[model samples]
Target: MTTKVLVAYGTTNGSTARIAETVAEVLDKEGLTAEALPARTVTSVWSYDAVVVGGALYTGRWHRDARRFVRRHREDLAARPVWLFSSGPLDPSASERDIPPVPGVVRAMARLDAQGHITFGGCLQEGARGRVARMILRSGKGGDFRDFARIEDWARTIAADLTADVRAGWL
Candidate 1:
């Protein structure tokens, strides 16, 4: 039987959606069947054998819908394999600095025993923010810092884990 994976994400300016698509592509290349969908559109988690939820961060928080999805489906998610990814931290100039993690989301993810979680740098459009948001973006030294190679590698690892679990009759 083919493994079914859902790559659900929430995006503001579309960077996180692209990242989710790329993750699905990587899983597809590894012979796993995956679908990339928006978090709001997914009504349930029962259909997928594994799930990967991702979203962009705004004001140091994840998209509300994404957080709600995890909270609502926590039990179902805990019963299966799940992974989480966050897209933010666009400070390429300070490569050594660590991006602060969102505590609420992190706590929710922990309940599901999430396979992994990652924070990727994101882009900020010139006029996409108000005065205060723009100042925050500027303070972060903005740039598109998404690393496709790293994203693909991470997806491959997820695929490998699922594959191994299936082979061992664990899934």
Candidate 2:
């Protein structure tokens, strides 16, 4: 059977969902069966051979749905090859440098023994929900900072690692 992967994400403005979809697309192209879904909609991770969890950073905190998903599926996640990602920084910093995961993500990484974690540039455009988002937009700070090339490169790396493990019978 093909290795089935789940790319689950929590997003307030939908930027993170797009990232997750990109990841799933890459994984599928790499010969793995993958799908992207909203974190809150998933009831379990058992059917997936591996999982990639992503969250949007808000006010220095990971998105609530992602946090809850990890907390709820810790056991299943720890048993498989899992990865984590966070999309937040409203600037080009994420693309320019390797931004570390937030504290909560770091802790979850340890607990779930995630294979890897990455921080990608965030996107905040007009019509984004929340007062802070509107305020940021009014302040002339809202823009799409996500680097698709970087995101694709990261997804490719993950595909390589997972495919290698599969060949070695580790997945």
Candidate lDDT (C-alpha), each = 0.84, 0.95
User: Per-residue lDDT for 20-111 in model 2, tens only?
Assistant: 99999999999999999999999999999999999999988899999999999999999999999999999999999998998999999999
How many clashes in each structure?
0, 0
In model 2, residue pairs whose N, Cα or C atoms come closer than 3 Å (at least 3 residues apart or on different chains), thus clashing, are: none
lDDT agreement of model 2 with the native: 0.95
* TM-score of each prediction: 0.88, 0.99
Residue range with the least summed lDDT across 10 consecutive positions in model 2: 162-171
lDDT of 1 by residue, 111-160 (tens): 99888787777877666555755886677666688878878988999999
Estimate candidate 1's alpha-carbon lDDT, on a 0 to 1 scale: 0.84
